[model samples]
Target: MSLKKLETLSTKLLLKNPYWEYKLDNYTLPGGQTGEYHYVHTPGAAMVIPVHDDGTLVLVKQFRYLWKKESMEFACGGVKDGDFLSTAKNELSEEAQLAARDLRQVGEFNPFNGATDEICRVYLATGLSKATRERDASEEFEVLRMSVAEFEDLAGKGTIWDGMTLAGWMLARRSVSALLKEKRL
Candidate 1:
């Protein structure tokens, strides 16, 4: 089945953030009903699955204002104008202070599916090298390196609860395992 778009109505800001805006859309359902949807108009973002050569994953713990607590998550940030890869690299360096020799796309996700129109491109950062820390002003992250088994134990025991972090770990572990089995790791 496919979803077909009917009509779109957008509101453009003439002042302050001229580029940032909202778009309201209308769609025709399969049963011939019209539905309206509102989405926050904005550019997408990126997240990283930082993994070491030994198949260990790197994650960060930081305070999330919305959740009012620290969350353990993969390195993530917004993609600036015309610089997706650089945004990923900058986010990794800022959050974890590590550069990867092999940075490749793992997957992508819609962080806010209901109202926002932002797609977070997920990547796997491997072969980490020497890099100095330069975290964002609003960010304070504590880094951790753990094996897949350790991560499984933590997740199973309810010790690690961050969804994004868990997803990154799971995907990276699967990829690493497949690569190792095929002599590609």
Candidate 2:
């Protein structure tokens, strides 16, 4: 096995439009070999772990076009032209119709490894209260509240899918336990 050095990376537009764009690139490898590839990239996004004081989590049930089915997933949405925290908060409200007083960054994840560039920021949201859910016209999702035990059960039972959501839940589970302990004292 050998390590590769990127001598150069040049980007070219394969498909250009206002809605979306596709790009092509050529990179020089370590052995002086140039490789060409095409990529379809999109802006980064954010996901939220909306937890209640009682160790409950807010999940959304929506139709995933890629999977061609509905899945029980955590609150997540695209990062618009705003701060990451604002994106998380907005997603919590829009997707779950809930808000939290205490919000913290859990972690970030990159789902694709081959060509596409997609980064999703995950956040932990607690101290939840009811709020208005102003969903976008394209957004048709339903919110559900479940206990942490239920989530754990779902995870074990193979119900809670979505790798990003699972990763965020794992981190938030530990953090929220400590947070709850601190609140108790």
Whose TM-score is greatest here?
2
- Cα TM-score per model: 0.79, 0.87
Worst 10 residues of 2 by lDDT: 16-25
In candidate 2, which residue ranges exceed 4 Å CA deviation?
16-20, 183-185
Against the unseen true structure, what C-alpha lDDT does each candidate score?
A: 0.74, 0.80
Tens digits of lDDT, candidate 2, 1-185: 87756765898989965434688889998778898877766677788888777767789998888988888888887665747788888988888998889888978877665766777788989888887867888778888888777888998888878777787777677777787677672
Ten-residue region with minimum lDDT total, candidate 1: 10-19
Looking at model 1, how many pairs of residues clash? Answer: 0
In the range 63-131, model 1's lDDT, one tens digit per residue, is 889979877777887776856788889888888889999899877767658867777778888789858
Supply every candidate's count of residue pairs whose N, Cα or C atoms clash at under 3 angstroms.
0, 0
Model 1: how far residue 126 lies from native, Å: 1.2
